[model samples]
Target: QGRGRRRRRVAPLAVSPPPASERGEEPLLRGIFEIGKRSCDVVLSARRLRWSPIVPESPAGGTGREEIIEMKDVFSVKLKRRRFVGQKKGGTLLGITIFKCLHKEENKLTDCAVHLNNLSEDHCNSWFRHLKEILNGFQNRPKSLKVFVNPSSHKREATHVYYEKVAPLFKLADIKTDIIRIFIDFVFCVGGDGSVSEVAHGLLLKAQIDAGKGTDYIPAPVRASVPLGVIPAGEAKQYCYILSVICFKSLWHIL
Candidate 1:
């Protein structure tokens, strides 16, 4: 018999475990609930909500699939109910509804709701209060917003876009909003360069006036009291260089 060639031996690659925050954190609450049509075992941690389908006992004993949603993405939580038309006094408690922002393709975000169905009102109420407290603890997220949309921008599609896409998400998130004719200290504009410049200029002028400085012969303009956010809804070809620089800075800040 010919001698077999020596087989090369390779060690298995080591896979790192998830971080302590993700893997080792203790759950705040655990319960049994129906998600969609399947019964599931649900768990809530400080930073995540997890649900796993409850599998029946089997000789082969396998783990059911688990789904997780980050708490940061959750915006609102409410007690779900079922009521007949014109019967608003009290409705049957169905379960809990959680509204969250879900990441979609191409870096877009969509509002979504998850219903945890349970017959017991007390159980749902406990979960609802815990979720509400968790949501309220996110201080970085805004509770209310003042929105100003330029109706003439993007072939007059800006208003439609706001109402159809943006407003719905805000509403679902339970974020109080003022669709301003004009409002707020920290203003934002949803239009092209002209709209941005107009808003920025007005803020600067207001800053100068507040500081008792004359507009005609101002050596140094006062800094704007509040920040301005720009949402590009129109083309800015001529100002592309400046916008790109600003965008780069914004991205840097975000990162």
Candidate 2:
């Protein structure tokens, strides 16, 4: 050949939608906000996210067939980049470095050996920049948040672990709370399917009481029919498997 031409190969851009496992049975964007003592994770669907608080009982009265109850409609909001950054730091850092930075950046940075040792100076600086962005964004976000907890499901120590390990991250995310009382948008049980049933029952009772007074006691859009989230804390979390509850083990992968 007298003349030859070479072709350049172009790399394809890869764009991925949120995993079905995280998005659940429906395709919707979810926003997770930390509300002080509690964390609220909201999921929005195209129409509305419906939750049934009660299931009708069987005629025999031995067991009741669960009936779906409609909860509320919500507009999906994508999880902010900062929230994701906070999650990443929570997994890596020991405590709320960002908040500590707000008050005493120098002291906090010096004390956090675990985080410092693991992360390089460049990484740490980048994280702080990301945290600043997140803090700026939180100013315009909603103040209230929903909380879900499974008191009876996890081992006795699990709660302590959550307090020590997880709670600080929420603080870092700039989640605020009342002085004495904590207002949770929604509280959920973290156990087997039975635990979910128990939570649903409790929520239904609360809803009935609120309805009697003609006041919305639970303000979160998902009040009585709050969305359920779970982490495998018990010996056998069979329900978690069915519902596709995100587990701690899988968190690293998803986030």
Candidate 3:
């Protein structure tokens, strides 16, 4: 067997893509930046820039959407967006401004900007690193969300409301919130508290946790306190009463 042993054949070396550091790839930047009293999560990636408002704690839905800046159409970063400077009060001022003109409608001009009022010096390095990485080329990290739609809740046309209200925002943010047993980010509960409570129980894996326990009732899991939201449908007890009185104003602003 030793005398008949065949010589080892070497495999040809194949080229691989360059390392992120070597390729001069940019790191994606994400953090809060403010405009007046409102604050938003600003994301800077190689291909695009976007900012989404920080939603407040409320059962009331937020209208905050991540607005994207198309790189192909972006001719220039206005002076305010070119360089982030220091503030007299304290901290760094990182700003992002965009002017959009649609391809189909070239004459249209829309301008908007958001500034980081006072980012702490301690956190500046990371932000600057992200900005540098974005300048080079940064890979996008997709977001995971849990979207719940209650079609049978309010009117017969409630599903239409969900498409009009929630889906577009998710699309803009490039988040996929497909149904799954477990969820990563916020759980948008569109119905009442009872269903939300049950969903929380399942998300916490209570059935497995409570298995083999002698107790008839499984106590609520401590980690079941996921961030949940319940929007009032006219069919529900609350918003129906409130909205009916408010003359049923269009809900476009809330979501």
Candidate 4:
């Protein structure tokens, strides 16, 4: 071994490991880009809401079926309500017995049959007077009266109950009304506060548009102008607080 110059073995160069984030740099960069894009999208959506002009669709007068289809996709979801009409025939044992007795009396006192031989004349006269008054009230109702019904107000069949049970009472009172769906005009809503707010907004927009068109001479429907009669069908009836006209019993009377 020539010991001219002992060259020490060169140590292998130490390689430094990549940083943790650097190892996953591609995914990290993609996530950041996606977040930025979403933020931009949200900002643009907000701007669109502010700048966009809302226009009412032309009234479709042919049949309501087509209009219902057109509006189906516009709202979030259909809210439903349960309603009962005049008491059912066989709901309870007591109800059944009472109905049976009334039915028996009516059958016996038919036009073809003889009047109750035992009852006094004064009793019959008083009953007939009361019946006449009720009939007169129903016969002389306001022609301008119109009823807006929201069948889907509550989770139950409230609309059905109203149509069957409650509506007849109005008719008996001589009020001429058509049980129209609230959606026909945007001025009616089914839920609570949000629903009423939407109706108010629609009315405001309609008023603005009508004014712009110089057709202010024509009056919008009364439902649009007056305070909406709320049925309080949903979880919250907050709008009722604002209007100061929330009444569970009067909902029947409003119709």
Candidate 5:
């Protein structure tokens, strides 16, 4: 009958459920998370932190995980719960600060931040807890860095400067750059007389240590003097002076 036909159509609609979301107990935290300086739509799900182009990389904001920052790859996350308050400037500000050392892409490491904004407290906190727990699992993560500190430089705090100013950028870039005394190649220097001497002396000291351990550092193919390149950043340049005078040519000038 006519009543039976109405029931069949109604049944199909009921079976469809909510096609968009899967009975979300809470809403998903999805917004733009800045791919470069430009804003893009990012989704924070239970599994992964994913982003897709809102600026139209293809049709209809594309689809699927075109760019994804896996939860496992996330290293350090600093959650910011501050909102710039005032009548002039007021919003429910939530930020998920991600300092990530991403998994290797083409056998290379990448580090970056997933900067997010305009999220509810529930969404932010949920993502925070999830992210924190995942990051905790990586406490025993392996790391490598090569740190060169000029002790007698102008500020006499080159190491401190590296720790403060430079290291944060390295962390953001997902680049490992903070282990001490770890260069086997030509040790390049760019400070005053102390710097040049320190590097040259350090290499010899390292060589001496290696030699004492019965390890021949100067192997068959690699010669005694490895090439060192320096682009000077200071006024007093003893390394460059020595190189130019002796025809060693530490600095390369392009014609």
Candidate 6:
């Protein structure tokens, strides 16, 4: 007893809530789930998902601590379940798993996951359907992307970077990707200046061809149907860095 010391329990930190207008009128669904090893009261709204830890009532009442995740940050949701060894048939329902994009240093975005563990299959399925519908309603999100990787860029590390770091996130988000197909909801490139230039040129060329014109078409080349995104893996990353700054600045203003 003389050498041992008692550990003090720290109060949970409270996070600021989203604006009322952003959350809309009412929650789409409400349920009890285990999050972060704590039993939480979860609420899913049109624009965000919120959760608060459940604690016994004290004389001081609640601490008003809650966590909120904006729907715009969420990329995918999947039903969680448990399957025993060699059990391919229907598994026991666990709950729902949400994959979201988290902002990190140097204008980077990475995947983060939150698991809502509940054993009730019916309850979980209801929440899953609502979450899926909400996600599908985001028309700005692309379902498929055409990827172009320059294996020669940066000592031939571009391919490795794309496969190792980028492809897993895309797969987790349930996005379909094709390297050589013409049909695409978006265009993604991983390389340096040369690769970026080639992809841009090729998109414009394809647009012109789709408009029944050739490469020499001068009267304002048709615009590409999908947008292009770049991942800098080459020596010349200054342009990409600058673009990221501008984009984040705009987002900051919007927020």
Candidates in order, TM-scores: namely 0.60, 0.21, 0.29, 0.22, 0.38, 0.59
- Model 6 ranges off by over 4 Å: 1-25, 59-64, 85-89, 181-255
Worst 10 residues of 4 by lDDT: 93-102
lDDT for 38 in candidate 5 is: 56
Kindly indicate the candidate among 3 and 5 with the higher TM-score: 5
What TM-score does structure 5 among the candidates reach? 0.38
User: Lowest lDDT 10-mer window, candidate 3?
Assistant: 75-84
lDDT value, residue 189 of candidate 4:
51
Query: What lDDT does each candidate get?
Result: 0.79, 0.40, 0.50, 0.37, 0.58, 0.80
Going through the candidates in the order shown, the clash numbers are 0, 7, 2, 13, 3, 0
* Candidate 4, 47-145: lDDT as tens digits: 010011122252631211111011111111111122358754423211000000112384442111111111234433443343233333343335446
**How close to the true structure is residue 214 of candidate 1, measured as C-alpha lDDT?**
92
lDDT of 1 by residue, 136-221 (tens): 88889898999998664444567898999889778777899998543244465667788878888888887787677898987888
Full candidate order by TM-score, most accurate first = 1, 6, 5, 3, 4, 2
Point out the higher-scoring one by TM-score: 4 or 5. Answer: 5
**Residue-level error in angstroms, candidate 5, position 120:** 1.2
The TM-score that candidate 2 achieves is 0.21
**Candidate 3 residues 8-86, lDDT tens each?**
9999999998787544224366667675667876766666666677788746645387677655444323213233365
lDDT of 6 by residue, 1-255 (tens): 756888889989999887777556378899889998888989998888999887767565442379999888998898987999999778989889999988887798878899999999899999999988888999998999999876544445667888899888888778998864233455677777788778878888866766677786457777876567777788997766766654355345444
Model 2 accuracy (lDDT, Cα)? 0.40
* True-vs-predicted CA distance for residue 31, candidate 1, Å: 0.5
lDDT of 5 at 22: 43
